[model samples]
Target: MPDEVIDCRGQRCPLPVIAAARRMPEVPVGTVVRVLADDPAAAVDIPAWCRMRGQEFLGSVDGPDGPAYDVRRTH
Candidate 1:
């Protein structure tokens, strides 16, 4: 389970990534933050965001609405 779950289901491209960026800093390092996004762009953007931000992308899983992207805060 993730330490935090950010719901970006109805949001578009940059919003999901933006929400993650805004909220990730509040979580403790080594904890997981899950972003629930329905936008197709999330599939690509999430992992890229993780790479660019130096966080660990733990991959994603199917959710009721969309995919749940798991990110481990490394810093």
Candidate 2:
């Protein structure tokens, strides 16, 4: 499966994480979730959440608005 994009701009802490968690299952293993978030905390929170969830933190990129993360679920 190909990676999917989730727009999390304007969303707060747990919202972005929760939104990603909800969409993650739709994506197959080895695929990634490209989360676009404007939350500054996401720069740290997302990676930590991925780690805690046993997902692969593929890293992030600077988008026009904010940082976007690439997350691959292992399980």
Candidate 3:
């Protein structure tokens, strides 16, 4: 399970990514942050954000409302 779960459902493209970015810094390194987003852009953006931010993208899974993207804090 993720150490943190950010719900971005009903939000649009950049909002989901923005929320993840905002929350990621609060978690400890090596902890997993799960982003629950319904926006289709999240599928692409989250992974891309991980790459750009130098974090570890742990892929995604289906959630109750949408897909949940997992990212581990590497720094």
Candidate 4:
């Protein structure tokens, strides 16, 4: 299935994290989510959030717009 993508550019710390959290429930378990962010702190924050939430942090990459992360939720 096609994963959902959340573009959180220009948003700050908690907002980016919050946006991801909001959509995460809709993603279902085992599916991936691509979070595109450019807040600089997202690199650290996103991973940490994923860890705390028991999600899979598949890693991140530099996309054309900014940084993108591959996250998978596990129930």
Q: Report residue 25 deviation for candidate 3 (angstroms).
A: 1.1
- Residue 58 lDDT in model 4? 90
TM-score of candidate 4 on Cα atoms, chains taken together = 0.91
Report the candidate with higher TM-score, 2 versus 3: 3
Worst 10 residues of 1 by lDDT: 59-68
Q: Which stretches in model 2 have alpha-carbon errors above 4 Å? A: none
**Which pairs clash (backbone N, Cα, C closer than 3 Å) in model 3?**
none
2-67 per-residue lDDT for model 3 (tens digits): 998888899999999999898888888999999999889999999999999999999999967579
TM-score of each: 0.94, 0.89, 0.94, 0.91
Decreasing TM-score order of the candidates? 3, 1, 4, 2
Q: What TM value does model 3 have?
A: 0.94
lDDT of 4 by residue, 9-52 (tens): 88888888899899888877988888888888889999999999
Tell me how candidate 2 scores on lDDT: 0.85
RMSD of each: 0.9, 1.9, 0.8, 1.6
lDDT of 1 by residue, 1-75 (tens): 888788898999999999999988888899898999999999999999999989999999996857889999999
Please report how far candidate 4 places residue 31 from its true position, in Å: 1.2
